[model samples]
Target: MLGLRILVHSIKLVVRNWRVALRISSPLIAVLLVFGVFMRGSIAGVATLGPDEGVSWLAIGVYLIAQTFSGTWVAVAWHRYVLQEDDSGAIIPSFMGRRVGAYFMQGVLIAIIVGIVTVVAAAALFFAFSGLNSLVLAIVLPLVIALVGLWLFYRVSPALPAVAIEEALSIGDAWRATRPYSGSILVLVIAMAAASGVFGALVELTVESSTYLYLVLVMVQTWISMMVGISVLTTIYGVVVENRDF
Candidate 1:
């Protein structure tokens, strides 16, 4: 089956790219380590909001926006520089500013769309859960949610490479071209996400007030996020390149 083939091919590509990512990420890893060591005490002391606790909505909005922008930058760098396609080597950093800006904007756009979908999905889930005694609704609601989530991802997954290569500003066009490849893309994304989760848990486990532990946690989390972002962009690019119809 096509899905099976995609899965196998993606795994192979991921394996091949793993070493390249490690090499590309070395400088970033070192910087994070140094920064973490210096900032550990302050960062560790900063309290995070607990679940279900109310916080400033404005602050929350700003935080989410920043996260989205950062995620986009990571995605862009992975595709544009890390993989390098047929290029002799990674692109020069002096000219990479434009690429980074474009990717950041794409990330912001995708984040907004994802946010809207998330809100709608949450509201729907709440209503569905409340009315789940109705078998028809129970059976239908989950399918609807899954489809919406899938469609949202399909719309966003290809934007990284599109933005990197063509510098596309139109997210809609990217979505259209990426549709046929959505299923495989999603599988690859989920696999990378799982890998990210494992790395995150490792960081969480070492969290403590001690400066050493705090530094370790921050350094680990940052590079892991970068790795996940890189894996995602590379996987999506490989999927589209290897399977034109995908």
Candidate 2:
């Protein structure tokens, strides 16, 4: 199947670029691990039941977007730095720190913009569905919004690396370079998201009876989910670097 092929190729690419992949992903993993420790209680609270649960989930969604943007920026910079070991002797961080910094700032800006967009979109949807049955809209709206948001995210996903490695600030350039394999990249993202969702659900199901178990499970699941996302990004970046000279 096509999915199998994607998986196999993704694995191969990761292996081929193991050094670069790990170099990029290791620091990111550490950062996310620390971040999760700090944010676990808050994120877990988002999953609990109440009239405010929907709002809490939406907030968690926005937080996810922010973390994704931050991590993606750093991932790109680290990958670039590793790939440049041949010619520049790993001078990506040294020579391109300013560009990386700019992209980091841009990532923050993108996170804020995404947060605002999510909030506005949620508000509009909430109002629009005011007359609809809560049960139906609850299921439908979240999926619809998540899919749309992910698509939009995929559109600008490569911008960080474009800025970090290529020194290009314009998102337009990133889109162009990423265009050739957008479909594949999006597939990977969706698969990773679905897998993480399933894993989280399983964890929640297993830990439902005990608060301590729930907290532990949630923290572990969150870390694994994030690691998987970063791993996929690392694989994609490796492919990109191999195919293009960047």
TM-score, per-candidate, Cα-based = 0.63, 0.58
Best by TM-score: 1
User: What is candidate 1's local distance difference test score?
Assistant: 0.55
Off by over 4 Å in 1: 1-23, 41-75, 86-95, 132-151, 167-169, 189-193, 208-211, 241-246
C-alpha positional error of residue 134 in candidate 1 after TM-score superposition, expressed in Å: 16
Clash count, one per candidate: 1, 0
Per-residue C-alpha lDDT of model 1 across residues 43-150, encoded as one tens digit per residue: 233223321123344544444454445444445555655345533344222235677687776666787887788778868686758756677566666555655664
Model 2, 1-246: lDDT tens digits are 333344455455456755654444554445444434555544456445422322356656655665565455445555454445422334122334566566677667666666677778878987888889888688988876776566455545556555556644355554565667767656665675677678767878854486556766766565444444444443444455345321
Clashes of 2: 0
Looking at model 1, which ten-residue stretch has the lowest summed lDDT?
A: 44-53
Which parts of model 2 have CA positions greater than 4 angstroms off?
A: 1-78, 81-100, 112-134, 179-186, 208-220, 234-246
Model 2 weakest lDDT span, ten residues long: 86-95
